[model samples]
Structure formats: structure tokens, C-alpha cells
Target: MKGFFDEVRANLRSPVLLAAWGFMTAMMALAGPFGSYEQIALPRRLIVWLGLTALAIVLATAVRVVVYSRWQLRDFWRGGTVTSALSVAILAPVLRHMAEVAGDAYLIVPPGLVEIAGFVFCLTMGFCAFRHALETVPPAAARAALPMAPADPALPRLADRLPEGLRAPVLRVSGRDHYVEVATAAGVASLLMRFSDALAELDGVDGLQVHRSHWVAARAVAGGGRDGAKMVLRLTDGGQVPVSRTHLAAVQARGWLDQT
Candidate 1:
């Protein structure tokens, strides 16, 4: 299906993320086989070791994503490297065990502590390499959608108060006592009037009510910022509005990125 293909494209586009995952997996597999499996069949040992290692790697990636979502390249690199190193250290024995099943003899290291420490050191090195690779790849910028123009003749006339170049067809109107908030390309504003009265007096736009207090033009959003768990949209002329989590996916799908 078209949707499935689109999803595939999106996944394929994340080269850095994919590379990180791949390297983690390879390290796990290599180290796990080296550390375990004298007691079990090679196949079973391999499966158990690989599966556990993969899970650890995935968990590491998830943790990094959550903690570093907004981090700059320098920070992200440092964190990711640290994460990779710790992950490798933790998973090394498992990898060594798997490798043992394949008939490779591990060094008879003492107390297992030294092996773990070695894992930590190797992991750090691997992650550092990954970060160095990312230096060549630039991150994508954020963007947001803009509102559509309104129709009705009276709406344009009402919007006429704005500069000629700033005029956009009114999409929706809402009331705050005597003032009506209009969603236009120029930005939202309060004009003295009942929102319902203004809607009836306007024409030619299609949009939906976001809430009782606000109606966003279908395209007026440019991008947004996060305030803890909340998303704040930065509109034209530097005005900001909150986009509820309930509507966040919609905003993301519309490709709104903060320009401010």
C-alpha cells in the first residue's frame, strides 16, 4: 500500500540512527559469543544471546531518544557514546557466550570483571566513532503549516484593516466578549464584534474548531516549541499558541517546524 511504502521510506531515511543500532547489535553479537555458551547447544545459545543483546541495544536507543531529543550535536554525540559504551559493557559477556558456541575460545580472563571493563572501553570507542561519523551529516530543520485564506466578501472587507500585502482571506472567527479573534495569514487578532456575527458576515474558508477558545487556520502554523509536556506553536509575526497533545500528531503531520 502507499501508506506502507511511505513508512518504509521514513525508516530508511534515518541513516545515523540505523547505523547506531547496527553497530550496537554487531557489538552485542560479537561480545556475547565471546563470553557465554559452554553449557548449551550453539543454536540456542546464539538465539538467547542475540535476542537479549538486541533488547538491550533497543532500550539504550530509546533512553537516548527521550533524554536527548532536543540536545545539540555535541551533546547528543557525547550521550550516545556514553550510552553505547555502557551498553556494550553490560552486554559483552552475553555476546562472548554466543561467540563461544561458534567454537571461538575466549581469553581466560580472571574474575569476569576485567572482561566487563574491556566491554565498557570498547563500547565507548564504538560510540565515539559513530558520533564522528555524524559530523558529516547535518540535521533536518523544523517547519510548520500555514493557514488558508478566507472567502466571504465581507470577511475580506473586515480584514481590509490590515496592510494590503498582509491581507489573507479569513478562515474562522471566535469571540472574546466584544472582540473577535480572526485566524489569518497575517496572524490572529481581536476585532470588536461577536465571533458568530463575524462568521456569518464572512465567507469562502474551511477550517475546524480546535477548541471553544481557539480556532486555528488549517495552514497558519509555521512550527512549534516544547514547554515540558506542552507544544507551543509560533505563528507569523512571532505570536504563539499552544497545540494540545491531542492535536500534536496532526501538527507534526502538517510538517510545522519552529522558525523562531
Candidate 2:
């Protein structure tokens, strides 16, 4: 929840989103689409549209954050597409009902579901495309580091998933689509499986699930990588993984920080 809310706060701070919402609200109010023009006066229309859209945006943001944060979605750009589709499917009908109540308390049937859904789908897709087009990089990392620990004997289950050459000790496991990318002393290999399944194979591994999408072996963590306000766990094999706030307490409890 902390990670989700933190993402929401960052998104809400975007000036581009604020401008878009304002413009969209003004357009909806002035044009009075659906049956709104006949049922509402201009002042009332402004208030209704503003409030409705505000609520719509909040719900939309929540959906987007959830989708974008999916452990399997390593490609950030692809996440926008999923987010828009999910937002339209989830928010359109709900918003239409809100419109019905705001306009005339369902006294008259609201806009057809198809109509509302189409409008929302187009708007969301456009917003996602525009937003992603401006992105030059992925979201940055988090704070903290890891301490050195030694690995136990390699388990056959995890070893079988990797290529013969790279089946060394697991340094980290990152989720990507239906696969778990296992990083080891040799290299990273993507095993066809869910993140949970990957972790299950390494049950006795001395590591922590520091993020929804990542699991890091304690021995592999080398300290001293920082990205602005965030702390990134540097690995023995020259990799860095961000620690999500949800796992920060556990990271601390494990005495992983080397603030030195």
C-alpha cells in the first residue's frame, strides 16, 4: 500500500496530467455531451463535470498504478497499454453511472455503455501514448544496500531452470512476463515460470523479496550504490536493485544497510 500510494503521489504531481484534466473538464462542461446539455444549466454543468472527472481521474490513477506496478511488466512502455485497457474496462461503466446520478439521479437512462466506454478508451489511450512518448528512461531506484552472505549448496530445481554455464549461485531473481530472470555469478537466465515459483525453488536461499518483482540473495548484495534520494542494492556481479518501501522494514531488520 505504501508503494502504491507513493506512486500515486508522484503521478498526481505531474503538471501535464493536471493540465490535461483541467482541459478535459472544461470541454466536458462546455460541450455537455451525453444528455447533460438538456438536463443541466451551464454553472451546474461545470460543477458536475469537474467533480465527476476528478473522481474518474482518481480511480483511473489507481488502476494505472496497479497495472504499471505489476511484477511481470518489466517493459514500462508496455505497461501504459495495459493500464489504459484496464482503466477503460473498469472505469467506463462506473463513470457512466456517476454521470447518470449527477445529471438526474438515474431518472433518465445515462449514456449507453458502449458510448461511454469508447470515449474513455480513446482518451486513456491518447493520454498513455502522449505520456510515454515523453519518457527517456525508466523510473529510478530506491535507497539502501545489502550485506555479504554465502550461498548454500545449489538446489537442483533452480539449477535445472538455468543454462548449464550460468547455473551458479542465484544473485537475484526478477520477474519478466511469465519468466523469472535469475542472475547468478555467471550470468542471468530467464526461466519460464512465475515469480512465486522461482522463489519456491530457492526456499532456503539467504535472500529477501525486496520488491514485488525482485528477490535478492543476501550474499550477492554489495553495498554503496545510491541514486539521489533512493538507495540501490549493489550486487557482487555489478547489478543494482531498488528496494520497495514495502520491504524496507525487513531489509533493515536483516541489518542489510552499510550506510558506510
Candidate 3:
């Protein structure tokens, strides 16, 4: 949960989020819905709308993280929908009251629940769309940016499930009965996912399955040779994985077997 709130606070610093906030705040200030254009002075209206939208964006981020963590929902459109709905449900009434204060109830009827929801949802969706666009970098381009580079929030899909400490270069993935264990410089973590699916998401990661249930990054291979009758690949962490007969040819072609 600590990771969750940390993500929310981090959103405030995003260029995309900041741009979206500024755009929405400016639009709201100009349009002056809820009678704020008539009731409040121009400068105060801008300030009030800026504060309102900022709060909404923060709330939407909190809702987004909670939903994803709990339901594992990651679809772009579906996530935006859930985020807007849940956010409106949580913040609409508060916004309506605030809008009334800004609009001055004595002069105008403020804004109804439905009207406030529409305005909030529109701004939230705008923020989400901008964030998604920024994160949609091409896989090849992403790979060109090496692990030594500063940590990118848009890591490989598999990294999303890893603990924060394990964000280093992924060393390997080993499949057990029902989960895949991922190894990184910091440590190892297990994710409840298919071994094949795990390997598929690791595009441009420069690795291959050395056996039916084991994949190793080229950079992580210390060497390879026979441990008794079984051919094995030694890892940087002093761990070893058996190289199966099915993948022996590929491993040999890559010259990994000669590294030892």
C-alpha cells in the first residue's frame, strides 16, 4: 500500500499531469460553469478552479491505483472508465458544494450532482489520456534505453508486478509449479503468471528460454558447462539452471555452452 500512495504523490510531478491540470483549470476558469463567471471575480475564479482540478486529479490517481492493485485491471479504456466513475462517485458531492461556494448560492443555483460529475469526469479522462500517451513508447526504442539509464516508470510489463527494490536489470525467470520467479540485482520475487507469458512480455530484454522452465538474460550468464551429466548455465548470483536437451542446440549456437 505504501507503493500505492507513493505513486499518487508521484503523479503530481508528471509533466503530462501538470499540462492536463493547467489546460483543464484554464478551460474551467474561462467557461465558468456553476455560475462562477458571474459570481466570482476572474482572478479568484482561476485560483478556485485550479485548486479544484488539482484535487480531482489526485483523487483519481488514488482511485486508479487502488482499482488496479485490487483487480489487476490494466486496460487503458477500461481503467479510465473505472477511474472516472469511482472518482465522480467519491468527489461529486464535495465538488458541488465547493462549486456553490464559488458560484455564490444567493445568485445562482450552484451546480447539480450530475453536472458536477460530468465536469470532473471530463477532466479526469483528459489527464489519463495524456499519461497513457506518454507511456506508450515503442518497445525497440525502450530497449535502446539501457538498464543503466535512470529508471523509467514505463518498464517491461513484467516489471509492473515486481517489488520496487527489484527494478534492476532482470537476471532470469524460473518457472515452478504455478508461478514464475524473477531474479534481479536487488533480489528475487515470484509472480502468479504463466512462464511463457512472462517470457513474451520480456521483448527486447535480450534473453531466451534455456530450458522448458528457465529463461536467462544474456548479461546475467556467468558461464555454462556440464555439472555431472547435466548441462547447466551459471548465473551471476551463483545460481545454476539445467539446460534441457530441447534447447541445447540453441544454447550451443549462441556459444553459451563454451563460455565456461
What lDDT does each candidate get? 0.51, 0.70, 0.75
- Cα deviation at 253, candidate 1, in Å, is 26
Best by TM-score: 3
> How many pairs of residues collide in each model?
36, 6, 0
Give the range of the ten consecutive residues with the poorest summed lDDT in model 1. Answer: 135-144
Q: What is the TM-score (0 to 1) of candidate 1?
A: 0.34
Put down candidate 3 lDDT per residue, 1-260, tens digits, no spaces: 66566756765665767888888889888987766677777798798778887888788878877764345454458767788888889999897776666455434676788987897788777766766555443344545573544546545667755655566778899886556778786666656578998888775788879899999999899899999999999888777899999999999988888886
Sequence-dependent TM-score of model 2: 0.50
Off by over 4 Å in 3: 101-107, 138-260
> TM-score per candidate, in order?
0.34, 0.50, 0.57
Ranking, TM-score, top scorer first? 3, 2, 1
Whole-model lDDT, model 3? 0.75
lDDT of 3 at 120: 75
Q: Model 1: per-residue lDDT, tens digit, 1-260?
A: 45334433433355665666666655554554343434345555556545654555454554344333223223434656665656665566765554445443433432254565576556555654564444322221211132334533644455643333435766445555455656565443445465665655444455434434454555555556786776776655345566666766666676564344
